[model samples]
Target: MTDVQRGTEQASWRTLPGFTTVRTYQPRWLSRDLVAGLVLTTLLVPQGMAYAELAGLPPITGLYTTVLALLGYAVFGPSRVLVLGPDSSLGPMIAATVIPLVTANGDPGRAVAYASMLALMVGAITVLAGIFRLGFVADLLSKPTQLGYMNGLALTILVGQLPKLFGFSVDADNFLDEAAGFFRGLVDGDTVGPALAVGVGSLILILLFQRILPRVPGVLVAVVLAIGCVTLFDLPERGVDVVGPMPEGLPPFVIPSVPLEDFGLLLAGALGIALVSLTDTISTASVFAARRGEEVSADREMVAVGAASIAAGLFQGFPVSTSGSRTAVAAQNGAKTQVTGLVGALAIAALLVFAPGLLRNLPQPTLAAVVIAASLSLADLPGLRRLGRQRRSDFVLALAAFLGVALLGVLPGIGIAVGLSILVVFNRAWRPHQAVLGRSEDLAGYHDLTFHPATTHLPGLVIYRFDAPLFFANARSFRDQVRALAAAEPRPAWILVAAEPITDIDTTAADMLGDLVRGLHEQGIRLVFAELKDPVRRRLDHYELTDTIKPGDFFETIRMAVEAYQASTGRTWERGPGSYEIPD
Candidate 1:
């Protein structure tokens, strides 16, 4: 290719993910994308409105969030078919962050502005993270921690919505308080029977459709049917609260303005939102990419989702995330590219402009039911069961996370989960498993001496295995274990370390090793290592331990180390029953 053409291609490759997708756009995929977009629109409309309500924003703002986020993702996203929109998981977070700041003012517009600014901050942080290629931040939430957080969030959401589902307005804070209010309202007979009927009926229908039909748009059908029933029977006159009319046009382009005094609070909330949003988006993108046998660039995904959040904020909407249900609809309906998302956005916009009155009679409780259904899916009881059965320690961590979120509020619960995740990682490394190696008749390779009582150890030789990286936290433990082995009654002349699992060695560990070597030499017990990695060996050289311990002390394999020990001692070896061999 020509140099100019090659340079242009390289620049294009470096552009946003959507640009690359569009550059290689296939004409035949347009029809499929259009169909997928239409199918996705069904779920988007109801979910957008419901999640917006969940976030304590006007229902119309959900449409705005849905449209702008989808369009933004379509223009910048890396995935072929990921959908971005108002999410159930993020709704409570946004509400918690923005509500307190705006509640005193009692100004709905200011509340929206604060939420939008929060989204803007989230966008800025996420974009910066992407620019710096900090995709590893997603690993902050380990699988068990994530499952626990989700389960807790799910319970909180479900309980919080119970008041609305029962057709009563309860003024309370936190999940437990709200639940108490719900029960009190029930005892007082404050719930409107008609609204309760609509909500419970809608939830049941949606669940049944999901279980039986699978292919049907259960949420859309339930919502539409509920709206029709309410409107046809004049349920509003019978005490059912309706969504009321919404503005019939696109969202206005406005810069969100927040009070300077509240900037710190917004910043704090934004950090939490960004963490949750990016984690959810990256995870959803990874899952979809894996199913299609494609690789997802975490940095690119971050940039795409960040751009979507910024777009939503600029359009007077709160932050958004990858929606599992909407994305599944797109994928199941044959979405082929980001074009599907763009089409869905346009479809939502058209609905707002032309048919805003169609859902005016939709019952509020039914919307709550929709959100509650989504929250139910997030519970993940089966995952908890699997963790309990597979790894008991992980199960404890997961259970702790679940309790933290369920009992505490969402934001505080997330903080607890993060701290616990760090502890779980540190605990593993701080007290990692160690073993002594011996030849066992039943095992192919060397087995742990303590586990195999009948296994035999070489005379005057001790093969110790430290199965973790040597760092400051564990360095002392390593020294203690080695010294204890040396102090044993049958003191070994040669202590050979199977260093294959010791991937890294830090400065503290190097110093510890230096001390260990000098102490072992005084006892006439040689300290040797077998199968040390090149990087670790280089680290030892840098520490000047190579001069203290001769280069010949390190060997490539256990058998080679044994051979060298025999050669140094001028000993002869022969094979017999229950004996080991040294290969030439």
Candidate 2:
């Protein structure tokens, strides 16, 4: 076929009849969405501020994050109920990037600028990645690695928030020192009475509500109770650390200034943030899409997330990703469209404008409690257990990621995860499965490979099936196995490779196969290929290996090869070429 006709045929295959399904958009589902939106908004308000604090920025920045992300993602995002905003996952990452650049006391303005720059960089990266359909890059961080990384992050967040909960300040930058500071403070009983009482009370309320109410917003309830108690008793005056007055008015749009010296530093941090953010977003989107029986375009979702982050950055917000908790809340509350998210954003904006004072009396301990409680859900013990049970190698990967985060840092942890995932890929490719196959007499029209030791090889012919793509990693092993098979006693006159499972052949493997074919030809044996995919065939053709092998040697199916062999032999051979024959 001509190149144009071949291209057309490939395009037609992608849109085959069975794969073309339409999406059903239901506008009527919005009738009860307002109530759901209200519930989600209530939960989002305090959580947003808490995450902003976690990100080492002013709490109001969290409000800005909620406004822009919700609106932006609602319009472009694929998921109807995915709530995008300030995320705990991105909190430590932002802090890691911003903390080193700013002064010890923290430059609120400069921090905001840095955050915007990081957001812009991340947005650009995501958009470019989406445009290039590089969504598969997220798979570089294997599931085990993510589990470990999250566990370590949860511990770090819990440790970092402890001082705030006790109304004491720690000057530690890293996780180890922060943990040590927490323990020292605990041992010395440096906890402020009012802050400790409020923190412990909030924790109790959240725990009780979660156990009893189950469906209600436990953290929101805890916040309300804590704030109400602190306000009624005037606890701040008695030494309780309160959030104190928040800035009013909408976030004004301003371009962030980047220092020429720090451009490389900021860019590197942004790349790390972008990769993790995309990984988290795609994963969360896939989970919801699967539940709804909806298909998610990962590349499109990346664009949506990128747009949200860019909008947020410009509007005085930091990096954001899809929140599993918020998405669950939206889904459970029956959100049917992005309108619910838009409504939630409107609600938060109203809160920021009108009730800014209400947050002033909110105790820092209560906010810490909120963060600790939210992070606890992200620990993912069940996922770790599942990984251990289903995939042992992945279990080790998860452990490595967890330890990397705990012992090293977020960046190092991510580096370890990616490295481990790549190693796993290479390990699999290095030693792919190869098996001898034969026709099954007991089964109708089926080929079965005898895996038991009692089965013996047939004389004069050998059939082998390679269960992976032919690549440079395993080319040497492939050559060794083929040579070994040819040198065996009662050497096979014909060696048919069941190429159905071999998806692609690299240049190195193609050259090795060509040499193997020539070697076999000199040894008075023929090398045949059966059930080769068009792509693999094209690669062989490109390498000029097609001319070396006779046209009739490349059978479309193993059955065709068996039929051809029987016709050539014409002995009514008791069994097929590779099959063991029993004396009758």
Candidate 3:
């Protein structure tokens, strides 16, 4: 290739998303980006460290992760205003995956290594998925399931943080155990009065500001006030834990390397984490993209998030995902592009280098309070209530997912959620909705017999509609319905399938149809199809079964089929007395 062409090709790949945003940078948006960036840093610092703590990592690692993730996403992420960082949802998953893997002494460094490795693996998985255009994997968890999982997750986080909030420690792992341990501690008088005062005061302050001053960053306010209170009252002497001086400067770029045995476990956790991250990112991106009048490129987003994950992992940080709350804050503050993220990252870097002790006096319980507030936002009881009122089936699915997460550990909960979602999809296809068609005097087309029971049908013909594709799972159901139609009193001369909804016919279904056709022929009944899609017809022909279905059995439309049937049988449509529906 010529040098110019080579350079141009390089430029094309480089223009994945973020760089294009840079090239087309608007001068008018700079001030807005700067201000929004500064405003975002307020939440970024506290929440990042708090989430890091939540994930069983050093608080400074959260800052490192936040900085790298933000900078990396700015270069690759398609969404201009989405804020990527350590998230509350991912924290529990990280802790669940990494904490147990640590040595008996609970090596902090080993935990960091495992988490960073997980981030790397998650990044690789997401990037590969994006490259293969597997972005639709994000739909693995349906909306109801997602809501339930989040609610369960919220409860888990809230309970897990309660011990910290009450100025005590719990020696339990899972949510149930932790809840029991927390209560036992409460009864044993583990609560530190002064520490509880600081924690509750911070929690109330954050909640009050969120409720009364929605625009203000309540987390930052709470952090500042809690630090002041701890410092002025010398709360550390009264049994309150605090974050001390952070490690100076940025972490050098170095990949986290863990034991080979841990690779399988880390990768497993990464798969679940990657899926959740993609689902969370795509949902948040869609909302922000719609608000800005842009279409969401989910694949690009997955790749971007992957890049961000890799960057953070290399810097000894855990996995990151888009924060909808943070994005909303940035958008509300007039953020125009990733420049806001750049500002936030740089500000955090400055804090690390210039003032590592800024939050030294901030109480650990205050951080717990920050996490509790975030967890509160994750629950959606109103959404669950709506699901219950809207449809019982949907409510059941949501409730099942909720129970799965609440009872099982976080990683296992995700597995159960995915499994339940897949089962729901398979059940729909396994026993699909089938309808018998009859003519209504006032209607334009044939109507479902179940809905319009008093409609008319020709005496010797039956029209059946199966509302799903013909596949291995539902093929038997379809055959049984057809057999039932053939067995009716004065058995139908023809059983015509309204094939519009049967989008595809798989090989197993094709063989089933072939056998059914031969059986019906012996019974003196002809099978006919109307409104069949061309692709499906092609598949039937490929199976060499179309020729066996009689020369003139297929018709372009239901009307054409009716006309042919009427002409051949010399019969007109008959009116049924009272209600008429399929016997079985």
All models: lDDT? 0.87, 0.82, 0.90
Our model 1 lands, by Cα RMSD against the true structure, at: 3.3
Candidate 1 local distance difference test against the native: 0.87
For candidate 3, lDDT tens digit of each residue in 1-584?
99999898677656466767767899999999999999999999999999999999999999999999999999998888999999999999999889889976688888988999999999999999999999999999998889889999999999999999999999887889999999999999999998898888888988998889877998888899899988899999999999987789888888777889878888889999999999999999999889889999889999999999999999999999999989988999999999999999999999999999888898999999999999999999999999999988988888888888888888988888898889989999998888888888888898887777645678788888999999999999999889988888778888899999999999999999999999999999989999999899988998999568765999999999988999999988776722324555
Candidate 3 lDDT trough over 10 residues, lowest sum: 575-584
lDDT of 1 by residue, 1-584 (tens): 99999999877666666777778899999999999898888889899999999998999999999999998988788788899999999999898888988766478788789889988998999999998999888888899999999999999899888888888788876887888888899999998999999999999998998899867889988898998989789999999999998888899999987779999988887887888888999999989999999999999888888899999999989999998878888899999998998888999999888988988998998899899999998889999999999999899989998888877788887887788888988988998888777776677777675576434455677778999999999999889888888877666788899999999999999999998999999999999999999999998899888777889889999889988888787654333222222111
> Which residue runs of candidate 1 sit more than 4 Å off their true CA positions?
442-444, 451-454, 570-584
By TM-score, highest first, what's the ranking?
A: 3, 1, 2
In candidate 1, where is summed lDDT lowest over 10 consecutive residues? 575-584
lDDT (0-100) at residue 216 of candidate 2? 94
After superposing candidate 2, which stretches have Cα over 4 Å from the reference?
1-31, 444-457, 566-584
lDDT of 2 by residue, 82-148 (tens): 8899988788888888878887886799999899888888888898898799999888887778789
